[model samples]
Target: MKKRLVVAITGASGAVYGVRMLQVLSQLDDWESHLVISSSGALTALHELTMRRPEIEALADVVHNVRDIGASIASGSFQCDGMVIAPCSMRTLAAVAHGLADNLITRAADVMLKERRRLVLLARETPLNLAHLRNMTAVTELGAIVAPPMPAFYNLPGTIDDIVNHTVGRTLDLFNVEHAGLLQRWQGLKKTAALVKESVSREHLISI
Candidate 1:
């Protein structure tokens, strides 16, 4: 059976993460993506990516309305492999931390927790307060990964797309999704140290 993943977009700053994840999933034949975008998420996408709801929904194999509490993904028997809330807002984080299944996005997250399925949240916020930190801790205790979209400088990303791709790629890594060439992998620093040592030896021989 094709692996199923639930992708939710909340009202966060980095909607591109969610959209990029859907784009990557769309290219994988062995994977199926179910998308749910909150109303505020839709607005944020428009503001950030200039993408309409239809345009974003097109990337998913199936799209569920945020208000649809009866969606298949909201049930533990849905047989989903995992769920990710890319660019998860602080509000959504609090809801999931407190087990508030008020909307379909949070509802499906609740299902993932109850079923012991993988749940990843790309929490997007800066200058986090105590409440945010405590909620993050709560979600962590509940088996939900609160992965904020922090950029890695080791990749030497040249453009915004590169940074975004690296973030999305790392998120896929958590789900064991195949995303080759999406970002540069870290090679050990031992090679660089060896090169430096060789250079120093050559310099010493020249001095002699």
Candidate 2:
């Protein structure tokens, strides 16, 4: 059975993360993605990625307006496997932390919490002050996975796509999604050793 997934894009600087997440979700056969974009998110997507709002909307299986508090996702009865907020803003995080469901995104998040569904928050902010950490702790206590968008250098990422894929792959991991060709696992390093051995052999022959 396909899992119902809710993806919310709040007012954050990293709109590319949200775009890549939607693109990845579209390729999944066993998942249905419901998307909600905050008003500032739309602007950020346009300014950062130069993608039009309609084009962004087309990426998701279902698009819900952020202002629509009456949306089905806001209710606990709407059965969803999990909810992910890619590039979650501080404002949204704080709102959800305090149980203030003023908008559809926070409201749906609250529903996920109350319903004991998986909630993954990709909090995108820097220089975490005490307040941010406190809010994160509060949500974590409620069974929400508060993942910050921190890049990993072990992947030897070369391009922007590499970074995006690594982040998305990590996000998918929270939902137990298997992602290949994104990041190499530690066990996969065995292949790199073989390549290095071959390179060393070739170098020795050339030197001889």
lDDT of 1 by residue, 3-118 (tens): 99999999999999999999999999999999999999999999999999999999999999999999999899899889999989999999999999999999999999988899
The top-ranked prediction according to TM-score is 1
TM-score per model over all chains: 0.94, 0.88
Q: State residue 141's C-alpha deviation in candidate 1, in Å.
A: 0.3
Tell how far residue 109 is off in model 1, in angstroms: 0.4
Worst 10 residues of 2 by lDDT: 178-187
Q: What shift in Å separates residue 72 of candidate 2 from its native position after superposition?
A: 1.1
Kindly give the number of clashing pairs for every candidate. Answer: 0, 0
Q: Residue pairs in steric clash, candidate 1? A: none
| Cα lDDT of model 2 by residue, 43-107, tens digit | 88899999988999998998899989999899999988889998899999999999999999999
Please identify model 1 stretches exceeding 4 Å from their true place: 198-208
